[model samples]
Target: MPFRINSQLAQLIEQHYPAVKTAGFHLSPVAGLTGESWRVSMSSGEMLARFHSPDRQISGADRRREHSILRHIARHNLGPCVRLYSSPWLLVDWLDGAPLAEDAFAGAAQDVLTQSLVKLHHLPLTGYRLDLQQQFAHYWQHIDRRRLTPAWLRLHKKMMRCRPPAPLRLSLVHMDIHAGNVLETPHGLRLIDWEYAADGDIALELAAMVRSNGWNAVQQHALVQRYVDAGGYRDLVLLQQQVNRWLPWVDYLMLMWFEVRWQQTGELKYCEWAQPLRP
Candidate 1:
């Protein structure tokens, strides 16, 4: 069983953070789909602490990967997320700005986000793997080995056959680009959680953000056009075609993720969401 932080974590906090003068401190649970996250309040300001459950299905390498990526982003002058400390037990940081509001997308914030992503794409990152095809295969193999539902398996296999647009230009992508993951501050937008960061089609991030937000087709088109304009002459046809091809695989990955969550929480809703998305 994963050890839930009850009293020991609180003691650890008092021992580490100087702001917390007393061992008895205020802690509030932060809502998250996976893992235990909290807002720890001291006399001065609050810090965010995220603890990955030992029972969660994440490899040690995954944690190391994110730690390295976050350090790199910090070094590159991205101000959204500030890394205070990282260890196997905790990831601590000063709280970021408020999450972008719902309407933040329709106004100047969209343009700002687009420009930020462009800057991110242009970063001189090397030595990282950007294998979308291989990732798809990994998810599919998990589905088969675990004997997932026939519907899900069928969708996985079908999506596996679809190919990405040829002539791929690999760049560092923020794989998870949702409103919640973005903070709108006076400085600019900041991306969080480098756990999913990797080199891949930048358009995949755009597609995932649009699809997850339920943006209309018009908005999706406008978003892509804006990115293309900022990016300087991207091939729109290839972008959309590749995005369409990857959509099914994205769905498959999401469903498998939910399955893993279900195994942890025994919640039917996680599996329920996967039903409609199944091919």
Candidate 2:
């Protein structure tokens, strides 16, 4: 079984959140990959309680970083996002909906996602700070001790070598846009899991989603066209080239991210899917 919330953390929450204390908080496992998140039920409504890994070495600052990004997104009304109730442990206004599982090109889900990305790209930054190379370097430093294969090493080096494109446009990026990260709510689609959020090329957001979700050629083209139509394509060819070159990097980082999560929660599925990216 995966890790469960300790009694101490539960008490901390009850002490802090008024809603949790009055109606009393009911804790159940919230399906997530990294960090400890739970479905917290109170008299008012449902909320998500996410706990950062206490390890001093990793994920300690992740909570704060995610908090900042979510606040930025929420303030600008970037997307159908959950409201931030607390740092790391957010009390999102429960959006009753499902994950969009259709092909990336079809249905309201596609439109929701495309429009959300465009909105995010145009939103002005308040205090978002991003150092992409340093971020990946930190992950690489931690994972390098495990005897990485030669091909994987090559991918890492190449990813690092690909510098920020000149005349680079800077805007908020969700960084990770996989199927599960998006929720199809009745109000609209709300994006969850802002852990890997950052400020970078908006194209990177679309590219990451496309490559990570394994969108087919037709679906990929459709999504890209939608982005272009939404004013995301002054330099479409360059953006596509950069996105293609960065695929290995994206794959490797995602694989390692899962590997670390497995260690944290004893969740084996994270490592199971990592095999495809293995050299």
Candidate 3:
């Protein structure tokens, strides 16, 4: 189905760039799980427009916060430059790059990814803290408890028992780090989708990388070693422990997300994703 820009959005686009009224909007095929994006070809150049997902709040996403973080990161040339922001709509300078392939995690890409993350973690605090347990509970509230299997129930119990270490050192983390969100440009590897970025334990970021990338135990160790090599967190033993602690929480959050998405779209793929946890 062709995605047509609504009258309201079209008017907003015209208001910002009147030339768009003539050249019109060209929708990008790269639709995200939480937003519809487009590339508007103007007489001057190209601009990226995004319509944030209505279901964003269910996952505790704040577009304004994301915009603020993007602006901060753009200063360091890490993300796209923001041109305009209006409520759920955001327009930014279009980036010319390709999303990393699933198999692109090895070799130079892995090194670049590690260095990029280390750099991001070193950034000053953004005044946003991600409470994983709280987020889990929030998502759990929207899910039907009866839908969970004994295995999932056990996992949830285990996650409840685990906790972050004392006096946690928080850093700016891109919680949703994965191949899809990473773009390989001429400049370097740039991370997109700042909606889930916040101040959190660096180990949580490591755990997310492992889970989202489907890394094996060896691969996980290698990635962590690379991170450590790049002057990230010391204390390898404690770092591994922290990463382990976040694994269950990550899985639970994603499981709840899949359930909520299934409920919203009645999409069989979401149900299929939820089934493995359903015994």
Candidate 4:
């Protein structure tokens, strides 16, 4: 969890944050699936420097889009405060928190999770809507299909044929909302890693949360009810139906992310994760 920062990396950090020049500081690498980041500790204050991917098409992270969302979400107290957003890096106030565990996420902290999502959906819609079909197609282009297993290829074909249902309501949606992405801060639960967040169907966001976290029928139903009670949705039955339709697509996207990342980085972990997901 702790490592020394080399001179080159230290110099890079200084370029992004000049305040580190005067103050004693420490740099530790943080675990990230794709892009690299560091927890910057300084005598003055703490901050996080999130590096953006060079090939945006492959990583599917729109830093500009994320910056736009963050600028607004910070005012609403939904996310971290942005200090600077120069190309290839974003500097923000370091939030003191721990990532929620899967057990606590579903068992004890489900109410907070549900309420936070309701608050997210209430935010004004960004102009861009998250298009999963296009995203899938983009990822597929980069992956080596010739090396893909028959099962993965079959899932790809199936995803291509399946039509996603219409939106229950169009709003700002955090497309990724697993336990690891939710931070338990002193103030409250806050969502992090906004790389995939954008304007989309509320039902799609719910489906991603349920399927990724492996929520059971009862847990899923309870979430829908809580969302409705929080004034997040009107028709519970309709939203549930839409979420059901989006489940398979969520599986497809998750699998493709792993496959594409594997191809892009030659990282065996991505391949390992995909093996269990494949049919």
Candidate 5:
């Protein structure tokens, strides 16, 4: 379908590439909950432009931080190349690949993903720490308490008391790393969507993978083993403990995110997805 370009986006494109002529514009079939994404084809090449939603569900995401992280990851040939970034709007080189299927993370694909995560964790910190408590509070404050069920409330309380393992080693983590965010490219797996990226507990990253992918115990074990095999972490017990601590918190965050999204879009799908978690 034809994509609509707003005046601001057109102006930004003009400012960046004054001489280039636009050949075509198409909206990507896959849309992000927090933004509208489009593929803009020009005489030079194809680029992906994302217009950030003003009422994005995740309140902790900072566009500047994401831009910085994207630039860093791009330097390592990890994610999309940032072409232009102006608050709430970003344009990156369009990557050609298919998003990983739910069952694709195994064997070689698993190794590639593990290596990528290890590489991502080792990147120089950007001095931003993801505070789960603070993020939870932000989302909770925005949501109407009446919308929360007893089970969710109890889980929230449990999450509040959960503590990270001592001597937490912070790493550059892609806070959202589900199958959808990973692309299977000719070279290897490329992780996209750095909006929630931050320097945080590495275990939280693992927990996010498990939570987002709905991996069973066997699958989760295989993933953890791959991470260990990649030299990402030692002490399986400790890693498991850390992941355990983060799992509930991740669920709570997701619940609140879905709740907020449902409210914003009046979409019953979001509400239905959240119902299973409620009391």
Candidate 6:
């Protein structure tokens, strides 16, 4: 669906970007998991503006960090160039390509995705460490207490006590990685949505990717070996162990995220998805 921007929204975009001749601009809505995104077409070029999620309490997103990360990565060609950024709104060059679909993401797609992620993982720290414990605490506090079953509380307590493997090394890790987030763009494979991106252990990112994609041991090992082969430093055994150790945390985080999203949108799908994930 196209985002028909009213005069108010049009003025807001124009206020931040006056260079685009008033001859006109258009907003076309783009579908995504979080945030309201619209592709803005102007005389200069196409840009995408993302409004922050309505309930930041649940998302635990820091737009300032996201904006900084985008600016930092775009220079390295790992992501899109930042067009403009202000509170609640981040505008960047519209990535012009389809997401790496499952069929297309195999073989060759895997190669480039691995290559790009290695480069991304090697970048300088974004000065923001991802405090999953702190974030989880925040979310758990917000979720309706009535819905917290004894089983769920038991699992949550266990998760809270479980300590993940220490960071072998920290880098600018793109916390969100998957086929959908990787665009097969004209330039190359570009990773979008840096909201959850932060400075963290690279293994955690890999673990999250593996868990999110439902990859088995063989496939997960393929990713680990791929990273190592792509010049990304990894202790073959240690990294594999770390990935396995982090899987429970990853799964729990995903479940909580879905629960929070379900609450935010009142969307049955999000709730339905969370059902199996619940305790």
Candidate 4: tens digits of C-alpha lDDT, residues 1-279: 112223444676688668778876887667853335777788878878777665554768887788888887887777888877876667788889999997998777878778788888898887878999889888888876766878777877877887777787899988888888889999998888888888889988888888777788887888888888888898999888888888888888888888888888788999888777777
**Considering only N, C-alpha and C atoms within 3 Å, which residue pairs clash in candidate 3?**
none
> What ranges in model 3 sit over 4 Å off?
1-5, 19-29, 32-35, 149-168, 277-279
RMSD, model 2, all Cα superposed?
3.7
89-142 per-residue lDDT for model 6 (tens digits): 778899898888887665568888888888988888879998777777877866
Model 5 scores a C-alpha lDDT of 0.76
Q: For model 6, what is the C-alpha lDDT against the true structure?
A: 0.80
Worst 10 residues of 5 by lDDT: 26-35
How many steric overlaps does candidate 3 have?
Answer: 0
**Candidate 3 residue lDDT tens string, 78-183:** 7889988997787788888988987885555889888889999889999988887787777777776667778777776666677744423689988888887889
Writing each residue's lDDT as its tens digit, candidate 2 over 1-279 gives 234444544666676666666567776766654336667677767766666655423532376667667767775444434545454355455557777775642655676678778887887864665665666676665553564778877876876888754424678788867677777766666777777676776656666777677776666667777777777666667666666655555676666666555565565686677777666
How do the predictions measure up, each by TM-score? 0.78, 0.80, 0.87, 0.88, 0.88, 0.92
| Model 2 CA deviation exceeding 4 Å by range | 1-6, 18-22, 32-35, 54-61, 75-90, 104-108, 144-146, 161-164, 258-272
TM accuracy, model 2:
0.80
- lDDT (C-alpha) at residue 246 in model 5: 77
Worst 10 residues of 4 by lDDT: 1-10
Alpha-carbon shift of residue 44 in model 4 (angstroms): 2.4
- Regions more than 4 Å wrong, model 6: 1-8, 19-21, 32-35
Q: What is the lDDT of residue 91 in candidate 2?
A: 47
For model 5 the local lDDT of residue 48 reads 83
* Winner of 3 and 4 under lDDT: 4
